[model samples]
Target: MKHLPTSVKCVALLAAALLPLAASQAHAATIHTQGSIQYVCSGVGQGSLQKMQAQAAKFNLGFWMVKGPQGEYLANVPVKVMQNGKTVAKFTAGGPLCYLKAPAGTYTIEGRHDGQLRTIQAQSGTTAHYLRW
Candidate 1:
């Protein structure tokens, strides 16, 4: 009898473990609005992740909160989406993944965790930032 190689088996196991996260690309999160901007912060579970992933394409920008080398997920993060010199949107994230629907323009996305602040630049329709700290 032939058996699968150790490396092949490991890869299969890793893929299986990540199936939930990888498979979910949209979800059913409530879309919240801030003035003219609309957003959703959801991805805590498989269902939510699936819904959020689906909803993400409608938005211009997205964020994923991550930490450490292993890439652990963070939740309820403080987020601020700034355009020009003013804040267009700000909220405590509902989950690890969040999407923002803003006008087509350059914006700064900031996330605060444990007193450490991280920022990234995003172009309305073409950026997904992973806030790692």
Candidate 2:
């Protein structure tokens, strides 16, 4: 029926167009595993970051990717997690933040961008770490 007002119709169309974007933004992140390590890298946004933060306590390794002269946030960075001089996990981060569930031990996190590399060390007790490049 062509009875609904123009304003109502516009609103309905807008909602329909945006529903997919909203759903994609809020999609649940997947947890990945390598050897004995379980990890996840999730994009940043109020809702998504909050979801990751809620489970932060369960992870022994955490990383925040940062870059730019003014410390702008970063995403999709290539990272590698290592322990005892062995590769533990190797993957490109899906977003600017990552969490890893690992045994209590020291770890080396390496991130590379634009031919530059940044490395950081983390222990089971450390809350989080910023890896800048």
Model 2 agreement with the true structure over 2-72: per-residue lDDT tens digits: 89999999999999999998886557678898999998888877578887888788787788898877877
Clashing pairs in 2: none
Model 2: residues with Cα > 4 Å off, grouped in runs: 1-26
Q: Model 2, residue 37: displacement in angstroms?
A: 0.7
Each model's total of backbone clashes? 10, 0
lDDT per residue, candidate 1, 2-101, as tens digits? 3989888889889899888755433357789998889888756756776677666788888789888998889889999899979998999978888888
Q: lDDT of all predictions, in order shown?
A: 0.83, 0.86
TM-score of each: 0.75, 0.77
Residue pairs with backbone overlap in model 1: 25-53, 26-50, 26-51, 26-52, 26-53, 26-54, 27-50, 27-51, 27-52, 28-51
> Residue 23's C-alpha lDDT in candidate 2?
88
For candidate 1, the 10 contiguous residues with the lowest summed lDDT are 21-30
The local lDDT score (0 to 100) that residue 2 gets in candidate 2 is 83
